[model samples]
Target: MKRILKRRVLIPVFIIVFGLIQFKTIDKVNMVVPAEFGILTIETPPKEVGELISAACFDCHSNTTKYPWYSNIAPVSWWMKKHVEKGREKLNFSKWSDYSEEKRDSLRLKSAELIEKKWMPIISYKIIHPEAQLDEDQRELLISWMKK
Candidate 1:
């Protein structure tokens, strides 16, 4: 009797886990920055700085997010959505041209300050995206670009 009970519980648990794993959802990957949205018509910040920012920050802060395959899973996907929404609220690089001159200046200053304090990338992000890790020189380059 005890063996039968254990089998019943294990079978259902395994099925549930398997079912959860099979469930999938589509990620929102259509992130087109408007033509009039950026300060640079030809892509700003030079190649290196632009690459760094895109890798480290654009996932949440810009319209063009490159979603990974795992982003379609539960719990993780929910968290990703929330983080992206919050990041956009704080500063949406894809909407930069919509900001007033004063607001843009303030955001640029804040971006520099955040980079100097090692606070912009958010530690959780760098853990998974090792390429997003900015060395001291990269950080300096970003700061210089932001200030300009």
Candidate 2:
């Protein structure tokens, strides 16, 4: 009787708490990306290379993030927002044209090193986004472009 009573009380409490938390939501707005500021518009890489970057890098590193369905949830939304903010702070590809030539060169070299070591498109991201999972050939192509 005591165990039955505990489950009855706990389940309702848990559901109520979960429902209440949903009130806190992350902003899902994707600001319009101007052609002048976009990396693809400025750099003009080959189609394959551009596609790879879009799949693996753009969501977090660019201003226009394509938020996933889970991002609508409370705790997950909060975490994803923080992750994207951190990524953009490191490098905002949407502001590529704003960077100086020297800075761009330095960023390219660093990007190559990070990709070569499989440190980018982080494991957690790749797990959910299979399209962002770059095979060896795809990784090589991206790394070569960044090295250039």
Candidate 3:
């Protein structure tokens, strides 16, 4: 009788835990404004530079994020939120106009330096996002764009 009761409780508990693990929630927020509305424009950046930056950094640094299916999971979503928030705070490309000219130049140089050092996409980020692993050619292109 005790063994049967134990099995009943354990089965229900396991099911509940599994169900909780499957539950997902998503909350997205827009964080960009027009460059004209602020103090900058994308007119200076080359098309390739813009494309590379978008593909590699826009998810965390822009108003819109292309959330992954895994991002729907609970713990992963929570972590992603934290990472995105911090990344945006550090350097929001979408809000480039809001920064002072000095800040803008400093950020541009930092962006170039980070890329040349193979540190922009970050190793941990590339581990999960293989497409972000830029080749030597891509790196050179970014470096050249930055120098301009």
For lDDT, candidate 1 versus 3, the one ahead is 1
Candidate 3 residue lDDT tens string, 27-59: 766754765532125545667767777788877
Worst 10-residue lDDT window, candidate 3: 35-44
C-alpha local distance difference test of each model: 0.80, 0.91, 0.76
Q: List the residue pairs that clash in candidate 2.
A: none
**Per-residue accuracy of model 2 over 19-115 as CA lDDT, tens digit each:** 9999998887877779689789999999999999999999999987999899998889999999899998889899998899999999889999989
TM-score of each: 0.79, 0.92, 0.76
Global fold similarity of model 1 (TM-score): 0.79
**How many clashes would you count in candidate 2?**
0
Ranking by lDDT: 2, 1, 3
Each prediction's RMSD over C-alphas, in Å, is: 3.3, 1.6, 4.0
TM-score of 2: 0.92
lDDT of 1 by residue, 45-128 (tens): 687887787888888888877777768776577778778888988898888878888898898889999988988888888888
Off by more than 4 A, model 1: 1-31, 39-43
TM-score of the candidate numbered 3? 0.76
Model 2: per-residue Cα lDDT at residue 30: 72
